[model samples]
Target: MNILVTGGAGFIGSHLCDLLLLQGHSITVVDNLLLGRKENISHLLNRDDFSFMKEDLLNLPVLKHIFENGRFDMVYHLAANSDIQKGSKDPGVDYDLTFNTTFNVLQCMKEYDVKKLFFASTSAIYGETCDRLTENYGPLRPVSNYGAGKLASEAFISAFSSAYHIQTWIARFPNVVGERFTHGVIYDFIHKLQANPEILTVLGNGEQIKPYLYVKDLVEGIQFICEKACERFNVYNLGSDSRTKVKEIAAMIIEEMGLDARIEYTGGDRGWVGDVPEFKYDLSKINELGWCAKHDSNASVRLAIQKALGK
Candidate 1:
């Protein structure tokens, strides 16, 4: 199978590319290097079955050429403005990057008659809901601009699926933590400790909790769903069964580093204005499909810290 992975030079995207390449599939990556680093995919640049285009997804002409030329068997769209706090700062930037780029991809898919598209959605789309989130959880009241953009893009994809008759899969991801992570709670904590080495300044009250997933587990689960599940439009939540608090994550990082750093907290309900205080997901749907996570939240965080520290 010929696969095109947008933002394939980033952390999760690069790992996805590695998985596809190992499966004996021809992979072409398109990345602009805005947030994605070239070193992520540097090893695969010499492979005969792997190619890359250094371009943004908003470039329709370039994207169209790739679609028309590669004739991709499937597209895994993971490129977008992923920073929730940054998105809250400048929503117009988020809208253009997330919504506009998604529209461009859909247009290219329609023009080239692409068969299937797997979209990377977010758990932020659920906002602060009362009940545990399910696939059927409704109204999509996103509190953050990043979440709003993702929700809007999901709607566009659903509309395109109905109007153009394309197969689409939407996976609402929790906090995906692993190596090569450019920015996130884990990365932030590690960097801060590295810089200070004495006191770690933690954002928020550190009581906020959220679900997390290891990158390898996430990729594996997606592979299973893509191979077995067949639906014009499918939506599922991808996350680990366990949840971890912010303070717990900080302590784990401190322990992993073998440091006696003091944790200082900034009192608040959340780290940021648009951040979700607490949320948990129901992963029974994906688990019922015979795909289960090997690592719990704490174990995943420890592994990610180890990798990030090059230990």
Candidate 2:
């Protein structure tokens, strides 16, 4: 299958591209290089089954041209402003980069007669929920611009799928960590400790517990869901079965790096204004489909740290 992956040069997206290429799919990557590094996809530059386009999806004309010429059978939409911490600082970033780009992608899909879309939705859309979030969980309140944009993009994808007979898969992912990770707690902690080994500045109270999934696990989970749950519109919560606290992650990083840094907290449940301190997803839906996450949250964190430290 010839497929297109937007933001395919980023952390999870690059991993997805690697998996798809291994599965004998012709993969074309479209990335703006704003947050996605070229080196992430540099290894695939010579493959006959792989191609990379240094273009932004926000440019509708360029996107349309690519779609018309490339004739992609399916699209994996992962392009968006992923920096949740700074989402509040610039409101327009999510609008222009995330939601607007989604709208354009759907439009191009419709215009090009493409019938399939795989959207990369986030767990942030649940918005500080006390209950274990399910795919059906609603009120769908997103506290940050980043989450709001993802939720909005999900809505557009759903509407487009139904209206145009496009098959769609929407997977809400937890904090994904593994190789080629550009940002996240693990990445930040590694960089911070490298600079100042004596003290590690922990965000929030270090009590913020959330589920983490290894990138390889996430890619496989997505593949499993896409293969098993074929529907006009599908939604699933893709995450690990258990949760891990922020302090645990920091400790793992510090221990792995052989550093004795004092963990310092800024004191808050939420790390930033829009940060959701703790949340878990009921993976029963995907689990029932014969897909279970292999790594628990702690193991995922440890593996991510090892990969980030190049071990």
Best by lDDT: 2
Whole-model lDDT, model 2: 0.92
Give the poorly placed runs of model 2, Cα more than 4 Å off.
none
In candidate 1, stretches whose alpha carbon ends up further than 4 angstroms from where it belongs are none
* Model 2 lDDT-worst window of ten: 223-232
**Residue 297, candidate 1: how far off, in angstroms?**
1.0
Residue pairs clashing in model 2 are: none
In model 1, the Cα lDDT at residue 124 comes to 89
How many clashes show up in model 1?
A: 0
Candidate 1 residue-wise lDDT at 57: 87
